[model samples]
Target: MAHSEIHLELLLGKQVLDSTGKPVGRLEEVRAEREGDEWIVRRYLIGVPALLERLSTWTIGLAILHSLGARNLHGGYEVPWEQMDLADPQKPRLRCTLEELKTLEQSNSQ
Candidate 1:
């Protein structure tokens, strides 16, 4: 298999599209784990909650939002690495429908 590299900085704020070309959300964080000598990406986190978590303010941010009547506000998706197509890097796309992905809240509760 051929190996490729993409800078995290470039992907961080880029919007990701679903399989049918619908906007999902911005790429906020990447979940990875070490495999021998390299770190392999396990999932990509997208949306406002992911961003708040990345910034170390998830709890506070959510509390504030909830208090402001945004009770339905929720975290983003925890897209499995295999579900994302990074062929273009600048324009990441999902390999499946948005509904097929697990939301951050769901993943956390699992």
Candidate 2:
């Protein structure tokens, strides 16, 4: 199999678009695991919630938002590794629609 390399830093904070060219969110965090000397990506986290998670303040941020009556304000998406098109690392995009991705809440419930 052929593989290409992209610096994680370049992907961070990049706005990810959907299949139809609609903006989804920024690439805030990347979920990966070590395997046989390789760090394999599992998924890409996007949006404000992802940013909070990357900063290790997800719980606290959510609590504050809820307390402020902003229950619906916190949101994000979890794009599976296979769902993201990284061919253009500078402008990462989703292979699927936003609706097909798992929301932060949905992933938390699982």
Candidate 3:
């Protein structure tokens, strides 16, 4: 299988698809940690809360997203980095089914 190198900026707004090719949501933020000298992505976060967090700096954009029905401020869906397939850099898709990705709540984030 051919793999593509994707940068964090390219992933920010890219669409995410489930294993079944269903549209799930967009890649909002990446949860990463520094190891030695490089930052490694641990999991991918998506959904309303993730979107809100990304747009927190832009109050206007945040307000618009909230108005668009993404009112959930305390939860998000998380897919482990290993579960994601980045072969198609333009469209990142998950290897596992939607149900497999864990739904993280407020407590989990902190």
Candidate 4:
């Protein structure tokens, strides 16, 4: 599908998955790169830093800074898309479930 279509539909709250066929997190946005006519997804930013930045505490900026450092060291996030079991497959466009996302975080962190 075209990136525009993907952007309009595939992003903004789809569940993300890890390489091991396990839940990883939910996509905050679809990071992409332009090459000729295609917009290839580079990574799924996972929403944590974005969420952190909205908070009213010293933690927000720190988390954003920390995420910047971490991403630099780890390189770009390479999301595994085929395995995504979207929270609402029926709608094919729905916000990821927070409870499922928390479950994914705990399961993948180890």
Strongest candidate by TM-score: 1
What tens-digit string does per-residue lDDT give for candidate 3 at 1-110? 54335688988878899999987788898888988977777888887667766767545766776899867554667888899888887889999888777776743756
Instruction: Sort every candidate by TM-score, greatest first.
Output: 1, 2, 3, 4
User: Candidate 3 overall Cα lDDT vs. reference?
Assistant: 0.78
Q: C-alpha displacement of 24 in model 4, angstroms?
A: 1.5
Clashes of each: 0, 0, 0, 0
The Cα RMSD of model 4 versus the native structure comes to 9.6
Per-residue lDDT of candidate 2, residues 3-109 (tens digit):
66779988999999999999998999999998897898998999999999999998898888789988666479999999999998988989999889889879989
The C-alpha stretches of model 1 lying farther than 4 A from their native spots are none
TM per candidate: 0.93, 0.90, 0.74, 0.37
Candidate 3 colliding pairs? none
Candidates' RMSD to native: 1.1, 1.5, 4.1, 9.6
Quote the positional error of residue 77 for candidate 2 in Å: 0.3
Once superposed on the true structure, which residue ranges of model 4 sit more than 4 Å away at CA?
A: 1-5, 8-10, 18-21, 50-110
lDDT of each: 0.93, 0.91, 0.78, 0.43
Better of 1 and 4 by TM-score: 1
